[model samples]
Target chain A: MSKTIYIAGLGLIGGSLALAIRKAHPTYRILGYNRPEKSQQIARERGMVNDLTDDFASFAPLADIIILAVPIKQTILFLKELAQLDLKKGVIITDVGSTKQEIVAVAEVCFANREIDFIGGHPMAGSHKSGAIAADVSLFENAYYIFTPTQFTQERALTSLKDLFKGTGARYIEVAADEHDRVTSQISHFPHILATSLMLQTGDYAESHEHTKYFTAGGFRDMTRIAESEPDLWTSILLSNSRAVLDRIEEFKERLDEVAQLIFQKNEPAIWKFFNQGRAMRQAMEIHKKGGVDSFYDLFVEVPDEEDVVLKILELLRGISLVNLHINEENREDSHGVLQLTFKNAQDLATAEVIIKNNTDYHITIT
Target chain B: MSKTIYIAGLGLIGGSLALAIRKAHPTYRILGYNRPEKSQQIARERGMVNDLTDDFASFAPLADIIILAVPIKQTILFLKELAQLDLKKGVIITDVGSTKQEIVAVAEVCFANREIDFIGGHPMAGSHKSGAIAADVSLFENAYYIFTPTQFTQERALTSLKDLFKGTGARYIEVAADEHDRVTSQISHFPHILATSLMLQTGDYAESHEHTKYFTAGGFRDMTRIAESEPDLWTSILLSNSRAVLDRIEEFKERLDEVAQLIFQKNEPAIWKFFNQGRAMRQAMEIHKKGGVDSFYDLFVEVPDEEDVVLKILELLRGISLVNLHINEENREDSHGVLQLTFKNAQDLATAEVIIKNNTDYHITIT
Candidate 1:
């Protein structure tokens, strides 16, 4: 049966999902409210969606699937507004918000008497750029798309929503609302706070010590990179997810104190164990990347910091079509082997490796 | 004035310094003891050094300068051994150690009565790859080379040492031993410990939360990138600079708690101020980077994740001889503008910008 998928926001997440859904299910009509955003305007100009509506409330009731891809606070407001609307039967409403617990609570309260099922969503894929202009069909590809279900949520709603977002090529994980907040706080939200704190500390130190900023090498720079993110967005993320962020901060202090004591006592073995365990765990994380694919092979190449260097490497492997080539900003802490290339099969990777070695003087390390 | 410069431990730092020195002052006689490491062996085979030493103490008397590029603990031992050796007068000895206070204190005790000056050196540049084989002549190029001078160090020694290392192309900063330790702990050492702690916390959180590992996104992965660094090297660094690291941890906790309070209170303006300050500081640091040059212009291009995409951009700017093209892993937090290209003049950058705009659909922003 043909259905209307009404997307409420046309920012990065909303716009990307519209493109992904359209490509995934051409039968469904994608009706979205194009805000005054440049990304949304550009997407409309490109004819990404089936239709546009300024009257969100009137058109919202026609949506079989409503995606609230607004800010966390606004998502709550949308849920409230969406609750009173006369929606289609068996409609599944979801959101792409950063924090889930509060939104899920509001969702459960709003949709309790209604036939519609609201599932909290947090798609963990985005770039520094915002808006639909920066949106791509593969924005969430290989990234984690999480679902936090409420007591009112049914299996039919969950599975249908998952199928709809499947075109994104993302890995799906279901988590409880509070548990989701705790986990995200441990990973994303708290890390942002820490990065900001580190920068502030370094900046404070630099005020007294001249040229201290100049001494921060690759590692320090990498750790504090997230501090450069937009403050208003982060402020909302932190405020909305306060409990989890605070708990993470407390937990982080304990973990840090443990290592600090080990260093203070001059316990080399313990300190080594601390760093080595982290290294081992981080390496393990890499192996689990793209876990669903057995045929995909990863190739890491060490590129030097020179003009048109990466171009030179690609020039060597011109004939072979690669699946993906990401500059592993993570591995960039080291000066070598920063480019991580993905191939759908081993044969392509092998051919690319031989071509790089035979044609260029660059160091090729397969990790 | 062709003087023999003996460098002990041809690791990444020592080997790169030797190469930089040779290219800078071709007439200088460079002698170094190559270790049983692959990096050193490769450097030796490449004729990066003029002479090799089997017995460092026996060859110590003939050198005008010596650089101890061993591990921090080993550097302390080498300093002790060199002190007792009948050394050449006015011989300047320096060690490339992470922690300066401990090593500089050791140097003062060992070289107090001798005519040689033991000026502590820490070249704030290195890759994840250790050993001389991984060393490049431009390893320390455009990096900070810090000097921690003792009370007995004279103007003659400082100037001569600076002159000798001119080939490194590193900006020199003179900081006191205690201040050096404190500053580095704020920027590098403390951040390393924090990164490890974050990874360990995430791993532990994953134990109870199913699929938690799969949920960690780019931001989390980026903040913990340095956790993948070597254990043994970091262990020595943390131990040698225990006091400063401990102090930094205390200060960090306070800074973190301040934000925590503001977040808990839901003071959005205050929280925004905290993060905005960090963003401003981090941005300020970038402007100061390569501050010596007046003609340098930086261009940031937002490249999408596609196979051979960067190659396409480089193809557009083929005629422009860019001074540098660095893949900023830091900016990878954002989905766009990851490639940072440097041009010596505004004309080249403007030309490259036009070429990119005309040739491709990629977004370009001048920073």
Candidate 2:
């Protein structure tokens, strides 16, 4: 028996789910429907789905499972439209929305008397890039995938739905919808707001002093990278979770004010204590490897800032077949360039350290 | 005749300068001094200086050039102490202090009726790791070395000072004392405060919601990297440039408030416009190559998240002798992993793209 899976919205998440499902269960037929007619064609050409349909009413009745991978507002509107349709009995419906409380609330009302079962899902994985073109079959691998089951959701239907995502290699976790919203708000939504605010502050400073922009090094750029996120997507997300985000913002403001007062009073000990606490807190956090997060073991080498010094070091690393190393030369121009060598894991780092120590006179420190 | 250069403070910056001078101009004798009696012995063992002296009175009169590589307050005290000594005729003096205005003012008074000359210098280079153990001879190559000369500064003395640093491969730029303070406050000092504030904000949020720390990604880590800086060093810097940093903070607060207002009102268009402007501004800034700043031509590739997929790609790259490549697997656990391949230059990036295109089925985009 070939299971039919209908994915509404052929964007990064939707398109990727389709690709992963196809690879995991080749006999299953995957159908995709996107708002922009052109995306359906692109999705098909990329082999993201086996079929594309223009009629949602006809498509709604055919799938054993339906996955809504649209914006939060759009997901609600689509759910309402699906409620009017005669969905298949024992059919399972889920969504990959960032926020869950509002979406799950809509699902309760829409499927109150319907045979379809709804599960609210939020995949904690995405690229900085978007759309079907950026989709991949293995995207959900090792990523955390949260599913919020409604009170009316059936055990068998939930099991079937979980089976559909078995190929994704995701770590499935269950949480209440409200808990989902609150947790995501703290970790994801609030950070985005802070990143944007920091960007605005930096932009304003740069406007007044044009030369200041040139002086912004890695720290400023890293702080503001999230500000370059797609505005339409972020604006929608911010508004959708406005209440929770706003609450976090208030808390953040209080903390900022305390630091500001310390700076104003020129209280050296207080400021130092504040920063020291922050440093310890930050260092204690477990490094996340999913999304667009970087994970590398860093090796700091104290070397002279000569033109060919980095090249010579790279050549030595190459001699040991360690080609994946990155050389950070930010300090090379000012002082003895402390070259930062990045490796994938501890074993590789340890190996590189031994090689450098034995082959060269440079002092190395593992960070 | 050999030129004698006395470097006071055998720390990272000062120690590195001594090593570089010795490497580039071996005949020029380098003398080192530090308040800690033990540091003099360590400095000698490291070969950072040709000689070490405990008596400043004797050391001050035997040099053609004297570099006070100490903290701002210590530099001022050292200058005052040197003023009392019977210094040699035409001895050029310079201090590698972070701030210049106050230091230059003190230098003016200290050298008023003395034969010794003083020029304010701030080498725009340093690493997170401090002290002589982290020093390297090539630290200043291609780095900007800013000098703030007092009104009484002699051109002959300035020329001699410039000649002493010729071997360091630094680009010398002269700016007024106040100008140096204002510009540095905008670029360096103010950013540090903002970074610290952000860290504190995040820390507060994490205290209430402990799980939030586990979700912090690359952006959070990068933003807070500077926050991990030595607290005592940062406290001294922030205090020395308090006035200018405070002014910048006021400007930053005003901008942040406006952003807060936009978020509070859910002004979609305004928020969108703000982010869009910030994105443009951030992208326009010159990419710096110091510290842990990334400086590589990036190529984004879409590949499945299988266990050996990245290894396979690396193997392919290695076959082509592409050893200086950095693979950023930020999205490996989600969607198709968009691996960012970093190359040394554009030409190398182009070559890798061609090789990958010819060898693999993956789609690549140069960013």
Q: Write down the TM-score of every candidate.
A: 0.84, 0.80
lDDT of 1 by residue, B1-367 (tens): 8888888888778888998889888998888875555655666786778878757686788899998888898898888899889999889999899889999889888988779898999887777666766666767766778999877889889898899899887879898989888888888889999998999888888898766676676667667888998888999989998998999998888887788789889999999999999999998887234332122468887776555565677788775765456554333334443677777566788998888888877778886
Lowest lDDT sum, 10 consecutive residues, model 1 chain A, at A287-296
Q: Residue B68 of candidate 1: its Cα lDDT? A: 88
Model 2's DockQ? 0.28
Ten-residue stretch with the least lDDT total in model 2 chain B: B286-295
- All models, DockQ values? 0.43, 0.28
Off by over 4 Å in 1: A37-40, A287-367, B34-40, B287-367
How big is the positional error of residue B199 in model 1, measured in Å on the Cα after superposition? 1.2
Judge candidate 1 at residue B137 and give its lDDT: 72
Show the lowest summed lDDT stretch of 10 residues, model 2 chain A. Answer: A286-295
What fraction of the reference interface contacts is present in each model, in order?
A: 0.62, 0.43
* Model 2, span B1-64: residue lDDT tens: 6899999999888988888788777899998888766566668878888888766667888989
For residues A105-214, write the lDDT of model 1, one tens digit per residue: 88888888778888889887777767766566777776778899866789999999998999988879888888888877887889999998998888888998886866
